[model samples]
Target: MSAIVLLVLGLAAMAAGYLVYSKFIAEKIYRLDPDFKTPAHEYEDGIDFVPTNRFILWGHHFTSVAGAAPIVGPAIAVIWGWLPAFLWVVLGTIFFAGVHDSGAIWASVRNKAKSVGSLTGDVVGKRARSIFMIVIFLVLLMVNAVFAVVIAGLMMKFSSAVVPVWGAILVALVIGQLIYRRILSLPVVSVLGVIALYALIWVGPSVPIQMPTEVMPGLSGNAAWILLLFGYAAIASLLPVWMLLQPRDYINGLQLFIGLIVLYGAVVLLNPTLVAPAFNTDVPPGTPSLLPLLFVTIACGAISGFHGLVSSGTTSKQLNRETDARFVGYFGAVGEGMLALAAILAATAGFASVADWQAMYTAFGSGGVTAFVQGGAYIIHNGLGMPEATAATLLTVMAALFAGTTMDTGLRLQRYIFQEWGEIYNLPWMKKGAPATLLAVGSCLLLAFGAGGADGSGGMIIWPLFGTTNQLLAGLTLLVITVMLVRLRRPMWYTLAPLCFLLVMTIGALLLQLRTFYEQGNIFLLLMDIVVLIAAILVAMECAAALKRSRAEVAAEPE
Candidate 1:
């Protein structure tokens, strides 16, 4: 029940996975060729397809995929029990997430850095690609919209975070030039970047920037923040990858790792015993059953479909060498696993007693990033002897930075989705970078304002579907990878096993949510769930057909 015990076990398992299992998967199963030309080098575009150093690429991939989900998911899932969430995070990261993420990057790299959605057309079928793209779009839409709101909410709620959150971007721009232009050595620049970022965090509380109560008539402060977030995302998306995205994500990645170290350090020093039970005998009345929900609830920390998106979408395009996928993609999964483990430790052990833990989880869907930041602040203060307000600002800035990086990547990925659609349907405008980015940002805003009304909070209305839809996409990503393995006549059991397990669990969870939505008369979510279910079914059929065709082609070849 000691926090250190949990932390040590999770860290050990993930380290072993990265060191041993990922190596095996990369060499034996993936058969990665060191000399194979990666898309980054082959395409050699300055904007989207620049070959990147493995360390910086890993930072971008890590922060983009880390987002708030890993923290939020495990933080919330602990309501079921810390033990279940912990085991899933440890096991799923090793067996499911690592393999899937690296496999996705490998798949995309082999196919010229196409996204998982586009790779589906080549590996699976065109029809499968169409369906897969829809699912991917919906997931991106939710991610871009909801994360904008999430970041804005955090900025509003923690005004002390405002300076650090905004200041990090300026620091990133300078670091980006320093690294890309080689004006400064990377080690020195990185150390300086981290130092500058932390300096901002130190100054944030003293000079908090609160949004005006009304930016204008009919626009509250929160709504103005949302608009500004989307505006920033739109600009960030259109900018070249190295300028803002890579450096920002990389610096954020550096600070977050330090943040995690602080958290894990706190637990080791204070040795807070878990107050939440291993299994909650006294369940919250309205909580869903644990079986399938746990899998979806703890989505990113364990295995998120979204990670596959990032792996294939952005990370694959920037891979310096084919072999770097293991370091960038799989180890990135380990980084997130460590974060989720910290969240579990924070939520379960941060509280003083069982009553305190129970009070936080009075209902399902409670205890997300707020729980993580508050609890993490407590541990930091008690263990590290940091002031509570300082500790809270630190954690808040970390969470906000994480969310902001996701929006940056999400908007860009959504832009890629539009460009992919253009390629599929032979539309010229959607293929253009500016137009695609506009469509990407435009669609999310439309959903926000069109659906949610004045406050631009409509994204929250469909937020519940994000977990289920994300899981479904992960399964389909694996399905596409499995089909590719079969086509190449590579051994696929390792990938296939997780794919099957996720599909079964996710489909079940989706159906359960569907029924619940219908019964509750929540027509919007019910319909969204049904649309996702249909898309999943159709894509599965296409992939199955593609799989059979691939098998026959392989079988007919003379040895």
Candidate 2:
């Protein structure tokens, strides 16, 4: 009903849960002892493992979790009405996401910073480790592929004018780094960089970039754009982290934070009337029921399997103290919940009329590119003080930049996982880092090219497949965390609540996808859904096996 009421409640819940409940979990249950030597300390390295301040680690954790998923998921879920979406985000964060992330960090700390995969093996069973790794690689592939489409769609719609906004942001980052971290005592350059960023926001529309035309031939604008995105990801992964991914994330995170604040302030100031229905009484013909669909639709904002990747991959290794993991991991989930709230507000508040909203929805319903650009434009113009056309273009550019960050990070993570997979499997070509890197790059290129040509329409097929795959990964992540908690001998109530909730929601959603595919008879979608369903079943089985092993281990030990 009232947007403000929902906002207040959601924000308050996030704060209290993070501050009070999370702290209790960390100190009483997990008992995160700072003196306990982490795997980072045991295997100290300047590159991946080094003790760092909690504040900076929070920044890293926040940036990793806050990505295109939050924006896209809420933007779509709000179609059902903001109430369901809002409730899911708030409650999910408190009961599911916060617990999952915090528990992951605690488990890693207790187990010498070994990854969730390794912990799963030790606690659950050796077989779970293999299952976890395979699941992770598949998840990363889908994540990289989907985000590639999202960014490319934005580029195609806004390439004519918004390129320079992204360029300006990147340039500002470079200058900031040079002045603050490199040149020392150069406040003037950093100040100038900030000014330039704003100036680009003002004058961004004048900058020219190539726009897709009919003459391009074969591929639609969306398809061609996505291909280029995967290409960029492949190259970005091969380079050093500092050169692209981290710097870009820093800039994007700041921009995203500012944009969200502006949008929320405007919404409160205007107090726009909600035009969309409180609930869509009549479900769309092919849509699933709200029960499971809502859970699948709002993966990133509520709970994501990908967070575990970030938690164990780099964040765990950089933790300054075991206790700090609670703040960085749990609070970071709350931060993402806030972003999802922003998206819900934007979607529900800014529409001028129900008719206008419906028209836009119908036009864009089948096209991910259309929905994203139009939604971005609506938020900028109606929720922020900006000209409609200019705001739309700016929003498109921002989307592209945000997608760029996701792609770069996804690609790098994928490469690392592939190399690990190779080593574990004893692949001859992947014994050395250089050859493995090349193989990873080549795999990315091939995937990109194949995605581009997969459908006669270029890359449209990738969008839905990406969504399914991403959600499946989230399910896998939930399974791993559930098993880890059980192995660590956490309270049964604490471990089983989130575990059962996610399992039911995810499996229900997967079955729904399978039904949709069977009815539509779309071979590609049908195949993808079948595969995801099988993967979900395997993940469940793996968790069960882990639980049995943990029980046996506990029983065999002398009491």
Candidate 3:
């Protein structure tokens, strides 16, 4: 089969979901009210809460939720074969992710813009809140830590990407000022930002950056970059959303879309034949069963609990209107679906032949970001006539920028989780922004250096738990939305059904990983997995009680 055929089919599916399914969700299910006041307007602080343009908010939500997972997950999952990964991304985005993401925003917006964990207290009972917050924190911890490592490794390997990735930050700062200060129209500013970012990509090859000799003892190059990244995230999280996060995500969103277009267009131009099987029946010695693993492996592009965090944690606070939830939330999932599709195509079809692709996938985890970058660069080199160095730099910067945006947002969300705990326990100091941010960054640092020693790759230790924990959190988040729907006497099959399916798959994956972790004598992951499993069961118990009560109340009232 030709790559163009898959490309056309995937893009068409995303478009149809956005146009048809999302409309039914926004109007008939979510019943979004355009005139409903949003927390962005209600809170209206110069800091975290500020009304934002829909395009800009969508960009923020899209890139922050996207991270490197959509790319990394699909790239890795395709080892099982492209067919399962492809089907999940297409269908999951339409049915599961779109509803869950947009519904999260609507639920939070209705409840005065509380984060999902905090709002769990309001709807699912206070006990559930504490349990839910723990899961959210773990997810963020894995996200911030592992992404820091991923970006640092990419920078070390693709030194040319280093300059453009950092340069894009400077460009975002300028774009932020231009848009907020009204110094330029959005279209003009957008055009300038994209051009400047691409120009930086052009300049990156000439100005490749290498880390200076160890800043301190025991700090390897990767560790130094990890520290620097966390430092940047700490500062970025403390800044106002309009100033850094929004503009950075917005421009990154545009740049990524262009990168997607280039990759998709390359597929069309080259019409590369699919190199991997649609469904591989060949035996890999230790490959896990495909049943639940594929779902967890492709968690982000399909459906993620972390996207619920982005939606409720930050996106809800910036939404200018309730109706924007559909775009900012649902279409945000679609954007990631697009990215996931590009990843599948790059990993499977960008290779020259079946044998070449086979060499790359010698093991379950062999073909990852490396495969993505190499294969994608091949297509761009062959199809678009771009210099090989430039093509590599472009994709590398794209991955780094998305990961950076996610890190920035994850740190901020982690800060909020701290503050939420503060409120729950009545700790005045923890509720403050500065202290909360310090705690967030400090904890992530402890996990990095403390666990991984000099390399700061400790996040990978817990990353195996990320997919299962994240999916369970998504299931929990959906439960919250479903309970709200039951309270309002609204149709809730859309949310409830996905909730059941995810919980079953995620908990099963958790149980499977537990056995593996135990057999390998990995005590840390074993303990962490057990903790997550317990938390999910406890929260589900609380939510079930709440759901029963909600249904009883609804039934007692007349329609």
Question: What lDDT does the true structure give each of the candidates?
Answer: 0.90, 0.65, 0.91
TM-score of each: 0.99, 0.87, 0.98
Model 1: which ten-residue window has the lowest total lDDT? 535-544
What tens digits encode model 3's per-residue C-alpha lDDT throughout 1-559?
Answer: 8888888898898999999999998998889999998989998997899999999999999999999999999999888888999999999999999999999999999988899999988888877877888888899999999999999998888888888989888999999999999999999999999999999999888998988557668778888999899999999999999999999999999999999999888887888988999998773677777888898988989999999999999999999999999999999999999999989999998799888998888877678777888899999899989887788788888999999999999999999999988988899999999999999999999999889888999898888889888998998899999998898878989998898888778878888888988999999889998998887777667666888889999999999
lDDT of 2: 0.65
- Is candidate 1 or 3 superior in lDDT? 3
Per-residue error (Å), model 1, residue 543: 3.9
Clashing pairs in 3: none
What order do you get sorting by lDDT, best first?
A: 3, 1, 2
Model 2 earns a TM-score of 0.87
After superposition, which runs of candidate 3 have C-alpha atoms over 4 Å from their true positions?
none
